[model samples]
Every structure is written in C-alpha cells, then in structure tokens.
Target: MGIIQNIKKNIIAKAMDKRKAANPFNPEYSDNFQLPPDAAEDQNNSHYFSVHDLKSRQSLYMRLALRGGSAPTEVWFVYRDGDGTVYMNERDHISKGESIPAAVECVEGGKKLRFTYTGPVKKGRLTDKGYVPDGNSGDTMVELDGNFSGLTDTFEFSRHMATEPVARALSREKFTKEFRAALSEHHQVHYEQSGTVTGSLKLGNREIVFDKLPAFRDHSYGKRDWNYFDRYVWLVGLLENGDFIHNSLIRYPAVTEIQAGFYKTGGKTLCVKNCTSMDELPVTGGVPEKFSYTVAYEDGSVRRVSCSLDFTVPFVFGGGTYFVNEGVSDFTVDGIKGRGITEFAFNADSSRWTRK
Candidate 1:
C-alpha cells in the first residue's frame, strides 16, 4: 500500500519533528530564506501569480485558471501564506468533456484575463487574531476588487511567473522567529493518517463538489489528538466548485476552526461535520472566471476515493484578489455537493511556481 504508507510516513515524520521542537512555537520558527526570483512570464493573460518567501519571510501564494476555449474547461488554484494567508482551489463543469488540464498545457500563454462583474456579493471577515508579534499567530484577511465591468472573454489562463522577486518581508520578530524554528524541525517526525478527498465540478454556468481533507499528513490537522490546530478557521469561499479544507497540526493548546461539511453520496462517501448552516454548501450562478472541484475520502473502513478537477485561475495579491464568492455558492452536506473552483494546483506545493 504505497510502500507501507511510505514506511508509516517516515515514522510519523520523525515524531512530528520532535513534537515540533518542544512547542512554544519553536523559538520563533527559524530562518532559511533564499529562492525567490525565477519564474516570470505573464504579460496580461488575465491572472497567474505564484509567490514564495521561505527562509522565514513566511510567504507562499499561488493562482491558476482555465475556462472554455473548448474541451473540458474550468480550473482554479490559490494558496496563500505570507501573513495575508488564504487558500482556494476550483474546477468547474467537466465530467464527460474531460480534456484541458495537462496542468493547463503547462502554460505557454496566449493571454486572457480582465475581471469586473458586479452583480452583487462581496464581503470579508476572518480573525482569530494571532500573529505578527502580537500574542497570537493565526492571521487572515480576504477581500478583492480592481474594477472592470465592460466584460471581455478569452476564457482565462495562468501559471505564475512575472519574474520571481520577493525574498524576505519578515519582521514580527522575523516571522515569529522563522515560524518557530520551522516547527521545531517539523515536529521530530512520526506521522500517520492518510486518506480523504472527494469530487464533482464544472463551472461555466456552475457545478460543485467536495469531500474535504486535502492536506493531511497525520493526526493533528487530520484530527485525532484533541484536534483543531490552534484555531483560526473561516469560511465563505465560492467561485463555483470545491471547498473542504483541512491542513493539520493541533493538540498543543488547540486552535483549529475552519470547519466544513457538505458533500454526499449513497455509495458510501459522506461528510457532515457539526453543522449549523451554509445551507449545506450551495453556491448560486452567474460567476465564472473558470473553476472546478472533485474530492472524496473514507477513513472509517476499507478505502474510498475521488478527486477530479480541471482548473479555475485567479490571482492578484495584498491589495486583494485571493478568491472568494466567485459564483455565490449555495451549500450542502448530507447529499454531497459542497462547491467552488476558479484555479487551483496541487502536486504537494510546487514551490509556489515562479514558473519553475
């Protein structure tokens, strides 16, 4: 089974990197910068902005999208980390038309991205307030607008490389002492808990799907040892399809709160997590820059699986673009349909592609 789950994830990633170096946020996170300026080549094809600021500047942003030039279109991807912190992924309408996603033809570019729709929906708020030299370090904020309206179309395309360049922007005691010395050398090792992902997406008019647990390497973020990693989870994402996030590590003081669940299947693939309401994960129409989503997972028994998406691209940064309410997601959970998509990528952190 994948080499005994990579030898039990290298013995639990070395005992969670030594309990993340005795907690207390690992001496401010440790520094290791160097590797920023390299990938660039998007004159104006709509949107694509890969970014990274390791060595403790603590940054990692990404965006990608594709929409109907023809054949199985719609894709989106977004990943954020340098303080602003956001994470979005999408895939829209493509079950039988499957084609356009060789990573969006590995992006050579023809160019097509303008933005400006204003039909309604646009709002933001997320604060567990915990970072930047304060007393907390959970940080989050998302909102976007630049202005366009007239409406043009080429479908959209992106990969990110407008010339790398963004080495270090830290200072909050150098990104909390280099993210607590890199989580105390990544928690001494010993990791486990693998499996969970669902799918269903098609965004031109709108289609959605989700199953949760995208980034799970073991118990913390995946849940098991008093779960909910340090709290700071928020929700309101809607591009068209896909929304079921969970990136692990919690237990020490506990702080995880971006809870979600709205994806159903009778074939034994369900996710319902303590609900209050998101209308079960709906997402209305009229929004499409290009998006898709498909995720599946089952850890209660044997093993079930699903994850099929093309792409949905979107990006800008700081000033705001991140990815939110692109199509006005409605919401669902028991019937299996949580949705959103616009541009997203996952190969296990491609280093925030500057194109490289």
Candidate 2:
C-alpha cells in the first residue's frame, strides 16, 4: 500500500509540473479574464472586496451578489477596527446603482476598479457571540470612496488545480467524492487578486484616508446556491516581505479538503500543493477567532501562517440557513507581520455543522 501510494503521488506531482506550465498564472491577470457565457444573466455572479491597513488596524469588507431577483443584488459592508465596528450596511435593501453602488466599477480593464459606496449602515458592536447591531444607533450614512489597483496578477483557482482529476484517475483507491465535488463547486471561473486601495472612507465625523493600503478581491460567477455548500475556509494576506498568500480549503459532504489559490513572492506565483492545520482552530461562540495553517507550495517551499482575529462580521442570512463567519485579522508568516481576511462559512443543513 505504501509503495502504491508513493507511485500515485509521483504521478500526480509530475502531472502538476506540466499543468503549471501549460496553464501558467497570468503576469497581470487583467483584461484577459473573461466572464462566463451567461454572465449577462447569471443568477449567482458575485464580486467581493476587502482592504486592510496594518498601521490603522482598520479594514473594509464587502460582498456584492448579482442575481437579478427581487433584490437584484445582495450587498453587505462592514468597516471596523480592534475595538469595534464604525458602521455596517443593511441586512436587506435594493441598490440604486448598476451594482451595489459600484462595488467593482472597472477603471482599467483589469488593473484597477472604482470601489465606492454611499448608503445607510448600522453601527455594530462587539459582543461575546460576535458583532451585532446596536439598534439604538439609527442608520448612519456612511461613505466609502476607494480604488483597487492590482499589485499582483489575478489568479483563477481552477486554472492551477489541473492535477486533481488526473490524480483520482491514477490512484489505487477511488475517491470519486472529492474529485467530483471540488470540480462541481468551481465549474466556473473564479479569480482572486491582491492590490492596493487608495481613497478615503467617511463614517460620520471621522474619516480614514488610505494611501495605497494593501487590498484583496475576488470575482466569481455562476450558480452560487448556499444550499449546495457544506463549509469552507479562505485566507488572503499581504506579508511585510512583500509576499502575497491567497488560498482556500473546501469541504463538501463525503468529500475531502480541496485546495486552490497561490503563494506569490518576488513577482512569481505558485499554486499551493497542500494545506494542513496542526490543531483545531480556535472558535469563539461558533466563529473561528484564530487560525493557523501550513502550506506546501508547488515550488517545493513550505510556509506557515497564523492569524489572530481582531473582529468578525457575523450575519445569518439565506433564509436562516447560512452563516458567514467573516473575520478580519492580523496575519503573521514566519514572524513577518502582516494583515488579511478570512471567511469561514457554515450551511445549516450540512451534517458537519449540525453535529457541531
């Protein structure tokens, strides 16, 4: 069995070597990214953006879902610090702009985007369970004026995972669940990029100006049905060494952990070969307050990253069947200080979440 496993591993490794070259990550990952055939009317298209400033320990996180339903879009925003949130968007509302009031307005094909929002928000307070709005504080008119300029080229997760299917075919053991589930989840183009956000965010009398604050964003489109998901963990960070790490681990029923994203440094991006955790993550009141993981890069380099979450933007939506534990945290890689964001989601119907 050991010998058989080794052979399978070797085969997958070789296939992956060829895979990277054949589907090499784009240097700029800009204008080249193409939307799906049904993007014009896709019901599950989504664009998410987050900006983190290490100096101020402040961050901006927003998600815009374009489904063209009664709501037309599902949008949410959270602005916060170590102490608590300044303001957060509505639990439900229809947008006036084309999209969440220009969540990702294209400025330069793929190099830059206009990230702005002018709307009402509730002031969320930190609590033992997580963030909850202080109802006493009425809707606060908050404005976020920002720009996202690509610092590293964009990367599509599926582009770098060409070995999964081939590995399942060659392996001695059959793991149809993993190979099939992971592929089904990412059947569409979903790309992630790290950039610099420049602009100012105004909430009430206070204002925070960002001068090229490192930011992270991802563009995903397709059928985004929360009912189909089990649970997943995602991490995106900018290290002081000028390296960028954006990776994800997904778990579906009867499936294993499927990996995606890359480790970028010195202008090169390498797909993650494997991701593992040494111990159980710290979950405070059902939210992962901290996470530590080790990743082996395709280039044969391994690195470990740990994050201490400052706050979590908690929300129970999707007909009360989904919970997104979106956490903005301070990340550290090998003692190099940095910051990033993490989103751990749970689907209520999944046995995993129910058992917990």
Candidate 3:
C-alpha cells in the first residue's frame, strides 16, 4: 500500500507539471497565489476607494481598513486643494451579545437609497494563513463619499438591521446566531451580505449607482503579539473611468510591509508583490504616499495612474498607526488624464471606511 501511494503521488505530480508546461499562464491554474494565510500578513486588514467629478473639478475618496481590538478603530483622509480640502473617513464597531441592525436612508443626486444589515459580525481574529476574522458588531455608522453638493456626512445606522418586522425579529438574534458567516462564499475572502445597499452618483454626463456589502477585518499584534501579517486590500466596481485600487502593508507588530496595485479599464489587474519600489509619503510618516503606478494588460494596452495628497488620513491602533494623504488622483488609462479624484471618509469611531 505504501508503494502504491507513492506511485500515485508521482503520477499526480507529473500530470501537474505537464499541464503547467502546456500553458505556463493558465488563469485556471493561476490560483491568485497569495502569501500563507497564517503568516502575519493575513491576520486583519481592508482597502476601498471611490471617484467623483463635482462641478468642474474632480473629487476622490479612499479608505484603508485595519484591524483593532481594544476599542472601535477609525481613520480619516484630507486632501488640500485650491477650494480648501476634501476628506474621507472610516470606522468599525463590534459588540458581543446582541446583533444591532438599522435602516439607512441617504440622498444622492436627488435619489434616495434604503439598505439593511442581514447578519451579525462573526469571525474576529487574525490567522497566519492570510485570512482575517471579522465580527458582526452591528453596524452603527453610515458614511458617504463622492460629490453630494455639500460637506460629507455620516449617519448613525444599525449594522445589521432588518427591512421588515419579521426580518427585524430575526436580527435581534442574528448576533448570537449567525455571527460567523463566511465573509463571502467566494474563496477570495471578500464579503457577502443578504442585506442590500442602494445609492447613486452623478459623474458629469453619467449617473452611477452603488450597492455594497461591508466586510470588516480587525486583527491586532501587540508588542509581544505574533501570528499574521498586518496588510489590507480593497476592490471596487468600475463605472466610466472607475478602477480598482489594491493597497496593503504591515502596521502594528512589525513595520515595513507594503503591497499595492491598481486594476483599470477592462482588462487584467497588476500588483506589486513587494513595496521595494513604492515611494513612501511624508504626510503619513511611513505609509506609501503619492507614487506613479502603471498597469499593463495582455492585450497590449497600458494605463498610468498617480495619487496626490491633500490630507494626512489617520488610523491609530494597539500597535502602530497609518495615515493616507487624500487629494487629486490622476489615472491615465491608455494615456488619458482626468480619471477622477479619491476621497477617504470615516465614521466617528474611525474603524472602517463606510461605503456600500
């Protein structure tokens, strides 16, 4: 039996090698290879961004979601421009016993959106395998980014509220019952909420709609703590000139960990595995500041992108802190400027970026 098992293993290995040789870059075989989940990098983190064109200029919003334990965490981004500075903020709240859900209504471009929380926070720890746990801490804040004709605003809303009374009754027990649902059914560790978010944005001649399922990951490393990496990533849906920005780095426990990338147009996304070439920003102390990034696709197309600073976005935690300079982000997809702006907004607690 031992000999037979060994022979089987050899055959499987040979088959895999043959497949790799046939197509070295098979999307099916390219498992989006990431660092080990249990490694320090995978414990707790987050990333998100949005772009808007208001009046004649452009406005942008972006947020970096990090893990926190002692209390609800938060951070904000401010961009300084001619007409003053724009801001982006984030926060996360977690409660153990009860699931708190609420109804959220916001007006964007004269349209109203109603959304509810479907479940409670479940996983809340950082592992070495790159998977960070999140909680159902009952949503308590609703923040908005982009152009709204006035200063940005945040609302006090339940994290996991029910749309109907029947749903409401279930939400009362959601925290205790379904507190550990998978962030998303997909293996990517994203998030999925049966609850819905509806919102809209008007970009010049185009009107954009938004629907989001908020996922929060808070893993902390103290002076003597060790288990995972402290890195975060954010992905957003693209409309018009919209693109996805991926940013990650080690904050608490150990410093000098950064990985960032941008996915633009309608092609493949590019990533910088190590932060060796990334130019750090002085505003955020040590965080990656304004740098030029380019994404090359398989179809012979190239896009150039850059992020400028207007403010020092702040994120204070148990181990360290992070700051993002929010301002004019010029993204040149195929060499066209005027991509849009990036704003970073947060709730009162400054735990997570409140977006759909």
Candidate 4:
C-alpha cells in the first residue's frame, strides 16, 4: 500500500510543480483574505507568525483564525521563555470583517504584518512528571506588540505541494456524512515566507524586546472544520546559510492524508518528493526529545535533517477539539546550524495525548 501510494504521490507532485511554474503565485494573496467557493458554509481564513529569539532561546507566536457560522473567531498568542515557561493568551469570541482578520493589525500587506495581545495569560510548563500549570498565573497580564517583515517571496503550498494523494483517497473512499465533514476541514490554499519579527513583549512589568529576529509567517484560507483531523506534524526552520526548510504530514480519518513541503537553499527552492517515516514521528511531552527525518527531493536526492526540541508552547482551540503543540527547535542539515519550530497538532477529543 505504501509503495503504490508513494508512486502516485510522486506523479501528482510533478504535475503540481508544472502547474505552479505556469501560474506563478500571486503576491496580492500575502495579506488578502480569500473566501472559498463554498463561502456560505465553513469557510475560514487564518494567519500565523513565529519568531525565535535565538540569542535568548525564546520565541513569540500568534495565530488568528476567522471562521464562518457560529464558530467563533480565535486570536491566540504564545510566549516561550528561555527557561521553558510558556505563557498563552487566547480570545475565542471576537468580531472580524469580510476581508480583514481580527487581532492581526496589518501595517503593510506582505511586507509587514503586525500582531498584538493584551490579556491575562495561562502559564504552564511540560516537565518530567507532565504538564504543570501556574493556576491561571493570578492576574498576570501578558502584552505583546510584534511585526513580521518578509525576507523572501512567499511560497504557495497549494501549487508546489501534493494534494492528489488525499483527493485520490477520498475519491475511492465512501463519502459518508462523516467523511464529508472531515473533507470540509481541509485548507486548500497555503502561503508562507521566511522573515524577521521585531517588537516588544511584556510579562507583567519585565519586558523582553525583539529586534529583527529570524521568523516565519503563514497564511491559510478555505473551509476548515477541526473535527475531521486525527493529527499533523510539521517543521519549519532557517539555516545559518540562509536556507529555509518546511515539511508537513497531515492525517485524517480512514487512511486519508497529505504530505506537503519545500526546501529553499543556494538561491533555489525545491519541492520535497517524499519523506520517510513521518507517520511514526513521536510526539511526547516529557524531557523535550529529538528526531531526524530523511527527505527526498524531486530528483530523488535525499538529505537528513536532525531536529531537537528546545522548548514548546501548546494551545487548544476549536472548543477543545483541536490542539497545536509548537516548539522552538534546533535543526542541523549537512552540518549547518539552524533554528525554528516544529508543530504537532491533534484532534484532542480523539487523540492519544488526551487519553494519556
């Protein structure tokens, strides 16, 4: 099953690359909110930004998802300290506009995107015994003001990544009402860029300042219903040699899945043809472990990326149905040092993490 599926995946990936070359990703999408054709149903638009202050071994992250229907708009902010303490702030009910996302204050379209948070934070740390919380942090207000400025042209996952595997699996699977619901949760288009984030973060009066630190930004828009997914894992990081790497494996119900990612180095960006053992990547909360991945490029050439988790910030959204566990990581590819994040997501209600 894996062999045949992988063959088809490669073929589809090749076609995707051709289509992408012909249709060059539009720049306007970097800051624009686009609604899918099924606009009346479960459409959603979201923006994510992350910057690792390597010097301090800390980071600040933001995610804002605007959804259709009674689903509330979400604005989440996370700050990770050098000592591994995680501070999180989130608002589930917020007013948003048709073309404007709430909480993400845009200074300029793709060039500079700004985000801020002003609220009490929940403090926690994943330790040897398990997760330890500070009991709501007792009125501790966390404030953040940060902006991301792009360092490269945006990469469109829709164009370069393979979605045919999922489409083909869905075509053959019985589309029960449950399957349709799961399909609705998929995000059809995704855009991202490597950049720098600069701003200031305050935790009760002790302030940490950010000044042009290496970062990453992502924008995804389409219909999304979190109830459909089982789990997902992705890693994005920047090398000292000015290279950036991103790869993800998203799993859904009944053998449906998608693998998408690219590598940018030596002034060229290449699509990853396949990744090995992604389904087996461990997601653990104890002692901050590490993992390595072997990825084959379009030419079938492979490279090893060793990633180690330095610290993580965990967040739950979608009314307790979804969780995104993100970590600041140190990555080494061919002996070059890099730093960024690795995200592990779960449908909490149906996840092993929750069961444990």
Candidate 5:
C-alpha cells in the first residue's frame, strides 16, 4: 500500500509540472506558487526617478526607499540600451534618515558605470505648487551629467480618494488618520513633471549630448509591501513633439485602484481624469508584451496610446517579480512617436509564472 501511494504522488507531481510548463500565464495555477517566509507587511516610502534619451538610445532609472520594517533604506540603479541589454547596481543602508549616496560606481570586466548626484534637492523642499527637484543635477553611467530644471507643479490623487472615506477604509489601522495625514502633509505621495533635461549619455565609449529631454519624478509613502498588491502596472512616456503621459494601476484581492497621471503639452500640464488600460501578457513568462490605454481629461478630450516592448530588464524583489520595459510608444493625439519606460509587478505567490 505504501509503494502504491508513493507512485501515485510522483505521477501527480509530474503532471502538474507539465501543465505549468505548457501554460505558465494561466492564473489558475497560481495557488501552487509559494512566497518566502519574510514576505510580511510593512509601512514605507519610496521615490523613483527616470530618464530616457531617444537620441542616445539609452535609458536610466533610480529608486530610493525608506523602509518601515526590518529592511533598511535602499537604492537601485539601472541603465539599459535599445537592444535590451542592461547593467544595474544596488546599495542598502541601515539608517532611514541617511541621504541618498552622492555617488554609485560599478565595474565589470572592462566596462565601468558611475552615477553621481551633482546637486540634490534637500528633503521637505515642498513649495505651494508642490515638491520640485529644482536645480537637481546627476550623472548616470559615467557619461550622462543630467541637469533637470523647469519642474512643473506636483500632481496628486483626488482629495476625495486620498483623504476622505476611501483612504480611511484602505488604511484601516490603529493610526489610520494620522498615517494618511502624514502621507500628504509630508508630500510623501506625489509626482511632478520636468520640462527639460540637459545632459549627455555614453554608449560604448561614444558620448551623445542632448539639449532637452522631457522627464518626470514620483514619490510614495505608507504601507508599500509588495505583497499588498496582487499586481501593478506603471507607465510613463515622453514624446519628441513635447507631450508627456503617466499612469499607474494597482490591483488588490478585493479592489482595484487607479492613479491617473498628468499630461503635459504646449506649456500646460493637466491631470488625467479617467483611464482604461488593456495589457497583453506573454504566454511563458507572464510579462507584458504590449499595452493599450486611453486617457480622458476634464475638458472632454481623450488620447489613445499604444506601446510595444523593445528592451526588457526582469527584476525580482522580496518574493515579487518586476518586468521593466523600455520601448517606443505612439499617441493618437498627433501620431507622435517617442521612447519611454514601463514597469509591471506581480506578487510571487500569485504570479502565473511562479507555478512553473
């Protein structure tokens, strides 16, 4: 009897593996995936900044975080080329109050990469318009010395959702009210647009300069555990024709949340009132291959957009998966073409690919 039971279990396990390998994107198999034991809840804040230069055919991304749990403050940097090749680095500190390191340098084989913050804006530099990284300068990949200026007003979520009943329900903890107030008062969760990026990026020892590059920055605070959301999608893009767009969508087990970003054009930036997005997931990896979205503004105008993946960097963090894609995009407003970055994250135990 014992031998017969062991045989049956072996056959069942093999069958499950085969099924997962055949259709890794199917959500039905997600139950078989497992999260690490350390995947606990936490309250934290993070800031993410990025730049994409079409002329140089290179993209740069950086992130800094103030953790609320056992984890310490951390920083991450990544540089990618048009061909999907990527070079990345990360650092962590034991103190949350510590500032972002002035420089990050990495060397591999015969290649070298360095990131330096030339003029970093101090914390709590909030103005009446919003938080701005005015006069901020940085160098990425040893070649690009980015000087960002002319930052637009900070964009935030609607007061009704961010402060009123909705926020209360979402943050139903012992200090719910105080937490929400701090999130806003400290400018913990906000995004801003920059009108210009003057710098140069290097590709294979060749230096490419740009007089103007559109850019954006965002910060978030509060409970930011990756396991808190089952899935998330973040997209930001800038066109050569002077148009910019940003959007974020988060899915919890019981509810879906959306934060429509600002659209800037013709020296004007307006918050997007409504957005609808459809993503096509790859069959084997659970990564997004294409995305389509429509943005509607208060003025009754809509813009349709589509993006196709060109370069990809897959990242795994705290039992979650992040597929970061740098690609070319198109907008229906003027058929404008541009390049930018998009990120999709999924909980490790809930992601379809984990079952495989």
Candidate 6:
C-alpha cells in the first residue's frame, strides 16, 4: 500500500510540474491581463475582504459571492484581547445570484462574535478606466453586533492595469482568453486596503469603547480555488505612526517558483508595490515564530520590517490548516521607527508531495 501511494504521489507531482511549466509566473501578467466585458460578468468571479484591528485586538473577515449561486458567502469574526482569551465564529448563506442584495441581509452570530451587512453596497461608478468603489460612503456598510460595535472606515487601493503591449495582445489570444476563463472558474482578481475601526468590544460582560483602532481590509473577485498554492504566507502590519504594510509569498508547485505579493505601505492607508524578499523563522506546528522582509517601489526605494509572534488561532477549511498569528512588529522606512500588529498565515499539507 505504501509503495502504491508513493507511486501515485510521484505521478501527481510530475503532472503538477508540467502544468506549472506551462503557466510560468510572469511578473507582468497581471499588469497586462485585461478583463473583457463578458469575463467581467462571470458569475463565478467573487470578492473577499478582511479587517484586523490591533487597538481593539479583534478582526472581522468577510467574502462575497458576486455572481455565483452554487455556494454560500462566508464571514469570520474573531476577537483576542490582552487577557489571552480568544473568540471566533463563522457564518455562511446561499445568496442564489443575489449577492448584492443578500449582503444587506447576511448575518452570522455566536456567543462571542456576530456580524451583519447593515446597508446597501454603494455601487462604484464603472468607467472605461476601471471600477472605483465609491468612497466610504459608497462602499458596503457592515454592522458588527456581538463582541464589537461600529462601522468600518474602509478604503480602496488603486488598481494596477496591464500595460505591456505584448501582454495586452496576448490577453486577447484564444489560448490566453481560454486559460484565464478557466482559471476564473477557480480564481479571481484580488484587491486590498487598510483602515481604522471605531466602536467598542465586550470583555467578559464589560464594554470597552475605542475611538479609533487600526484596521486592514482586502477584496478579491472571481472564482477562487484555495488549493491552487501548495503553501503561502501573508503578513499585515499597522504601525503606531499611522503606517501600514502587507506582504504575501505564494509557492506554486507547478513552476517551482515563488510569486511574491505586492508589498504595500503608507499612512493609515497604503498603496501596493513590488516585493523583493521574505524571510521567516522555521515553522513548527504550522506557525512561524518570527519574520522579516523588504519591499521596493518602482523608483528603486525600499523599506524593511520585522515581527515576532504574540498569539495565534488555527482555522481549518477544505482539509487545510491556516494559522492566523497576531504579533508585534517594528517598521523602518527612511530612518523612521513605528510599531504595530503583525499577522501571518501558513498553509500546510504533509502528504501533498513526496520527497525522493
């Protein structure tokens, strides 16, 4: 049985390698890929965003099914105060192609956490330039009812369009179109931003109010396949000096190459830039004790940051483990010092691949 299982694993790995070779990571791909009207209308395409508040020591995660009716939308609410106690809850509902409307009525509740979309999704103006989410007034309004109460002061990042002539031309090719369409059946375009959370949270029946808490939110739209990457690391930080940073590193087994996430930084709200490197301590039991990395913009400027774990909670889905860690970190940008919350996620699967 062991020999047979090993053979099966070897075959799967070889097939994955071939696929990765065919879909090599092109740094400029996203910069060049164009979404056709039909592609943009794909019901399978979806959007997801999450917010983490360090001051309040809580986080709210949400995902919307933009067009698809096959599955339900999900929300995850988490809270971790200084007392070492943690609270979390997950909720899901079938929208049946009424995502925009359903969002206004969606609700998830538990003893420690509860959330609801209290209002309509202020639709952003669609332009030939691209979709611009209406400011906080135009964005979706969500009411967190359980551990925390208050509205999220969310912000949207600038969109990066495909500019290379070659990429643009290839994007219109039959193969490219078909490939993207197929991938969309499982993936979507991802966008994110940072924000401030205002409201109060309950600590063992005691109500604590926060005037302003540092927060971060992200949104992705399209078909999403969580298993696309063998593993990945996502770290987000919001500093005391009103700065925010996000770093992600994804490993695709097919290409044996690592696709780094766009490193972003700025005051309260940050913009996305290219990342150079990500270094971290060895992971044990699916958690990394510490991490450090650097990000560079198009102008050749760079920034460095480091973080150490404070606590972590494990979330499992689709037979995979995601360890979300909250940590303390220091950011040095242009000789300035700032501190904030740093979080990391690691996806682990011991049997996915076999070593020779």
Query: Best candidate per TM-score, number?
Result: 2
Which ranges of candidate 4 are over 4 A from the true structure? Answer: 1-24, 34-41, 90-102, 125-131, 162-187, 283-288, 348-356
Ranking by TM-score: 2, 4, 5, 6, 3, 1
Residue-level lDDT tens digits of model 2 in 1-356? 47776687677668567766786555344333444434533346667888877777777877766664443567778888646665787654454354455355767755787767888788877776666678788877778888888888777665655464335333534446776465555465578788888998777787878898878788876656565566777788877777888777665544444566688888988777667731245433344666688888767888888887777776665667777777777889878888888777877765654222
Candidate 4 lDDT, 102-164, residue by residue in tens: 367567776788887777777877586444667746656877888889888788776655455
lDDT of 6 by residue, 269-291 (tens): 23234454323434444445455
lDDT of 1 by residue, 18-122 (tens): 544554221111111111233121111122222222222221122223222232222333333333333343233233255533131111112211121112111
Pick by lDDT: 1 or 2, better one: 2
Q: What is the lDDT of candidate 4?
A: 0.71
Model 3 Cα shift for residue 335 (angstroms): 3.2
Comparison by lDDT, 1 against 6, better one: 6
Instruction: Give RMSD (Å) of candidate 4 vs. truth.
Output: 4.9
lDDT winner between 4 and 5, please give it.
4
Global local distance difference test of model 6: 0.41
Predictions: Cα RMSD each: 22.4, 4.3, 17.6, 4.9, 17.8, 14.5
lDDT for each of the candidates?
Answer: 0.24, 0.69, 0.30, 0.71, 0.49, 0.41
- Model 3 residue 287 lDDT score: 24
Model 1 misses residue 341 by how many Å? 6.1
TM-scores for the candidates: 0.22, 0.80, 0.37, 0.79, 0.59, 0.54
Candidate 5 at 36: error in angstroms?
28
Q: Against the true structure, candidate 3 has what lDDT?
A: 0.30
Clashes of each: 121, 0, 56, 1, 0, 10
Q: What is the lDDT, from 0 to 100, of the residue 3 in candidate 6?
A: 55
Task: Give the winner by TM-score: 4 or 6.
Answer: 4
Quality of model 5 by C-alpha lDDT: 0.49
Worst 10 residues of 1 by lDDT: 156-165
